[model samples]
Target: METAQENRLNPFLYLTYLLEKLPQLPDPQDEKALNALLPWSPSLPLICRVFTPTK
Candidate 1:
């Protein structure tokens, strides 16, 4: 059975789909280096943070 959220168009789902089509990412430990190399591009956790609602 599909939940309400699943029925709706979710940004996370789209992001996941796009990510799945991309090449494999570096190790989590390399996040800092990745950030330095591509400040404009956000990591998975950072992407989640942007989508999350702040209290």
Candidate 2:
């Protein structure tokens, strides 16, 4: 049996795995379909923060 500490996974590693599996831009329109295909979705603020220019 694995210990809790041993079972722990790095969030950044998981995020990288998820991003690699996600569809390219111009995804499906249906929310259900999108959710079914995507492991995660960033909120509007998070998306804006990532793309927004740094001054």
Candidate 2 displacement at residue 33 in angstroms: 11
Candidate 1 regions off by >4 Å? 1-8, 24-55
Q: On a 0 to 100 scale, what is the lDDT of residue 11 in model 2?
A: 45
Candidate 1 residue pairs in backbone clash: none
lDDT of 1 at 41: 33
Query: What is the Cα-based TM-score of model 1?
Result: 0.25
Candidate 2, poorest ten consecutive residues by summed lDDT: 43-52
Error of 1 at 26 (Å): 17
Candidate 1, residues 1-55: lDDT per residue as tens digits? 1331342324565357445633454564566654532323334334322344579
Q: For model 2, state the Cα shift of residue 45 in Å.
A: 30
lDDT of 1: 0.41
Prediction-by-prediction clash tally: 0, 0
Error of 2 at 17 (Å): 0.5
| Tens digit of per-residue lDDT, candidate 2, span 1-55 | 1221133433444455446545553664667545543323332123212233579
